[model samples]
Target: MGALEPNAALERLYRETGWTMRQLAQEINRVGTERGTPLKYQQPSVTQWLNGQLPKESARPVILEAFARRLLRPITHSEAGFPAPRRGSTPQPPTLDGLVDLGRQDMDPSRRGVLGVGLFSVALTIPGWPDAVGRMDAMRTDPKRRVGQAEIQSVKDMTDRLSDLDDDFGGRYARPMAAAFLVNTVAPYLKATASSETRKSMISAASLLCYLTGWMAVDEGAHGRAQEYYVKSLELAGASGDRMTYCHVLRGMSVQAANLGHGAPAVRLANAAAEASPDSGARMRAFMAGQQAHAYALAGEKTNALNSLREAERAVNQAESQGRRFGGFSSATLAYATAEVRHALGDPKGSVESLHDHFRLRDSTDRQRSKLIFSSLLAERQLQIGHLEAACTTWNTILDEYPAIHSGRIDGQVRRIPSLLSPYRSNPLARQIYERSRELSAK
Candidate 1:
């Protein structure tokens, strides 16, 4: 039989039940409550219904229940307009084999790049961000040796390389490198490793790498790829049973969602991260709170955003009280996070302040030149908020630093300056910066 058309069924049901869109939504929510499945039917749901789009997976069951209740009969999937389940077909295995291959390649020493230098710099500057040896110690002390020193080293090396790529080339080059490392170096170990320590190490490394990859992907404007990497990282963290890592990955996911303009999911992911691991270290908890605040700001929930920001501050204070030094968190990391939240909240002054703070923390070493690509991003944001002089200054500084770095990633970011400063292209400072960027691009 031809499948029942959802649009036709929806029209008929609405007419027969004398239910307007609002009434139908209320009924669905009521049915969901009665059936122990709380439905969140937002305006988008109504729009989708009007456009004949199917409800999402989470809402499907609740929607079916509402239909059954309204019709005074129990409805099977077919009756509710769902397609029949295919029979006698084995389920396909997950297509993570490519990722496994890439993870292995990431482990190869030849693949390490200048970005590794930035990662090492961050580790040196940030106290809590562990190196291979530190991560190894953490794993060895664990009752399970699921994570090995070799694995830890591999992960560290990959993360460092990714950071370098980000610093040198922008995310365009960093993403492919990160994805390769995750698939080749990490996936195979994940698939075959049995020890708890090994698993934990693998999970931590994979989560961190995936997070980095997702960030790069976001920078490159590949939203779907970024989301996938974040989800994969979250899954890896869960498998390793590391709540802290899970929380971190969740926060990363929230950032991606927020960037993609999915504010609701962003808020949910951030809140879940904050709630799930309240006992985590103050730094970690603060990170989650900060993420939540950013999400709220993006959602235009000004009051909630401010509340979460305050909560983040409180967490930071608690972390400081716990004698947590600011090693694992770099001035750049903190500044970037703060700037992002401030920008979301439409506080340009605050954003600029945070960016300045980040700039203050940057290292003078050649190793850090690649990671300095973030300076360009900060300048771009400054331009957006009408801080033309500040942006011009930052852009000049970035261009000066770019020639010393051999990273394709940094080059890409520098190349973007011309376009970003196009509106002010006629301004002397802006013109100078753009010309310099153009010179670099020409190379």
Candidate 2:
């Protein structure tokens, strides 16, 4: 009839088990999130629990489990003053409740729970290490929204427009807008009534949007949030049976992971993307292989990197042989990636040559941001190998390109110029360039 002295129980448990309040809170939050029941518990929350406050409804079972594991004994709800989700304890929420909660939590700026969580193994829960590769059983769900092609097409159009914004401007400018759209608009549609076919199509479109949003998070340097978006995108892809987008999101995740110096998991995600590429067209196949090469190179796997690069080249040639011109994965993209791959593998000369090839064989579709990215890579490689004057020349081009381009990644690239030229500050040419770069960055 009365709440037990949970303070005594929790204190004894922590004292005997050597669990700090912070550790207990972190474990509770971790397990809660893993089960789609996110809690904003902190170190103090455990102290509150020890002072006789029951944990949040979603976090109770996790607290019980954490204590149980430490005690090597099962902890009852009555003992912990926090019962598990059970029959009659509370009515089960809607099927979409967890997703809604995630969206809500993501929208809440105060919830900093997942912001610190970094890259995790992509193969953790995937059976046979395959879902990361896009191999998934079609998710079967009864439809509620009468989502038709119109809804799906609207989502696609918005995606394309937002993507253009991301390409032209910076993710810093677009990420919040996209997040608001997802939480305020798309989340509602996902729960509305629809036919089976329409639901799949809508989910497919939503998956791409999620991937795009994830990419924006990457551009904004929020790797943990990007990973969350990628995971959700993959889940939506599976529900829609859209293997191609699944592979693409996996590739996206791999790219950012590599950028963060997470080589092993990056390599695994890239290989899974490659395995998922069999059903893709030649251009996409080549793109996947190229990604694998980059991942391999980052992991310091020279032989594998070179082999994957060759495979990419073969796929590209096969596509060109059949008169298929690059759309998504163009020759310029491959050339620049190859350049990076070479640089990563310690081939500075080859990297420079590949950049040369990229420019020489450039396509009309090469956007302004693409040029700046590749040129930055060229300058970076040259600078890395002590070609000070050559790097300066490349910077002149980047400086000229800087005014016309407005992208976060481009801004980051331009800011690197001063640091790159810092060692040569006494040299008039380097000083002039550094001063000019700093001036431009200030504007």
Over 1-443, each residue of candidate 1 has an lDDT whose tens digit, in order, gives 65434466555555666667787788888866765667767656765664566666456546654664576433333334444323212111122322343333333434444223321010111112121112222211111124467768878886987787675566655666676666544654554435657556666777677778767756655455555556556655554556676667666667767756677778877787777673666677667777787788888898888787777677767766777674444444556667777888778788878878876765653245434656766787888778898889977877776666654446667778888877887899888887888888788
lDDT of each: 0.61, 0.71
lDDT of 2 at 112: 35
Q: What is the lDDT of candidate 1?
A: 0.61
Best candidate according to lDDT: 2
lDDT of 2 by residue, 55-94 (tens): 6675565676567556654444555544434433332222
Q: Which runs of model 1 end up more than 4 angstroms from their true locations?
A: 1-98, 101-185, 191-208, 260-262, 328-336, 361-374, 381-387, 403-416, 419-426
